[model samples]
Target: MTGKIYIIGLGPGPAGWLTPEASAALEKVTDLIGYFTYVDRIPPRDGLTIHGSDNRVELDRSRHALQLACEGKIVGVVSGGDPGVFAMAAAVLEALEHGPQEWRALDIEVLPGISAMQAAAARLGAPLGGDFCAISLSDNLKPWSLIERRLQAASDGDFVLALYNPASKARPKQIFDAFALLRKLRPAQTPVAFARAVGRPDERIVLTTLGEADPGVADMSTLVMIGATTTHLIERPEGRPFVLTPRSYEANR
Candidate 1:
């Protein structure tokens, strides 16, 4: 008999953000598979076998999980954000679609968890209150031209943009170039936020405007949110300003 696989998102960083469904699935799984860092997050147990691999081997990890499930071992593929959002759920489904027929028969479930974008937005006050879209700045899987096209369209549409994987050591210049393009389409005073490691101990949130935004402040862990034309800021006397995109657009017209 074939066992099952549950692809779960562990949330942005903290265990508190993990959904009850994801936590329940994790407790039932016999094996866990994911990027080494994510896999290491789960505490070691007597029966659970953890399989950690490199970040670049998503397909390989999916296949391994599938193979394990076929051998009657319940597997959990852990991801950092919501598994359905640019995460392991798609990778696992892609593997099942092309892998052996037996793999297709196995039971698979994808449990949702809080995404980095959601966590970041919560920390800043409701920057996603209005129309919004999320995009990954990492071009490892797709072309940079395509990324630019999407960014342009989103800007033109006045959609609040939640940019994932903004910058890394290797791709240090892309964020600056993106800022330049956004400046052309959006106003200089458009609100921008760089939320890094939300929910983690080292969490940092920087609120600024597009004209004054410092791309150097971003890194791989940062989630950059560019507010729409209607977005506004509420300055507080005690803490950081609250960033929010108003829900009604009729008032702006």
Candidate 2:
């Protein structure tokens, strides 16, 4: 008699952006589980069990939440940004696949959300307008060597690079390593952008060239953008910020 589990996307923090479908699912859920900070985004509702945990225990917590759903409790496994983009959706699916027998039978639906990359790209005026790829600097799952390969591939291809999980306490050197790698393939004057605490009140956006940029300035919550060879900064008389990557070769030239 297990109830279906809903993997909900909380978007970037605003309740207004929560899709009606997601909101309805959240309202019906008897249990809400997510990274501690993300769980706080849901509006208060009665008869809901809130399960929060440290970032390290995401897989364990998600497994437990799915088990709760299998036990007949309506559950919501939440993620900040899009659940599909380097978020809980993939983790939860992996947990179910590799988990014990009971987990495989549970019904799971993954809902999308506004990812930080999309939000940041919007805020920065479309740096991701052309071919782009996203890579996470966190070595917790993927090895740094693999990250470097991907970064090199993307940089050499002149793809707009969106970086996530750029920095963490135990892996402070990762961003620096990536920065060094990119510097080798791309020009030292390549433009880069960073969005900190995006979609939240404390959010800040920075635009600068690679020569002036420092990876040490980033943290776990920051999203970094490194422009392709065709990317450039356009200055406005009003001092507005904009980064553009051309789609056509003529536009790029």
Best by TM-score: 1
Cα lDDT of model 1 by residue, 70-108, tens digit: 999999999998999999999999999999999989999
Return the TM-score for candidate 2, rounded to 2 decimals: 0.96
TM-scores for every predicted model: 0.97, 0.96
List of clashing residue pairs for candidate 1: none
Candidate 2, RMSD to the unseen true structure: 1.3
Off by over 4 Å in 1: none
Q: Each candidate's lDDT (Cα)?
A: 0.93, 0.85
Model 2 whole-model lDDT (C-alpha atoms) = 0.85
Tell me, by lDDT, which candidate is best: 1
Candidate 2 per-residue C-alpha lDDT over 48-78 given as tens digits, one digit per residue, 9 for 90 to 100 = 8898888878789778987897789988999
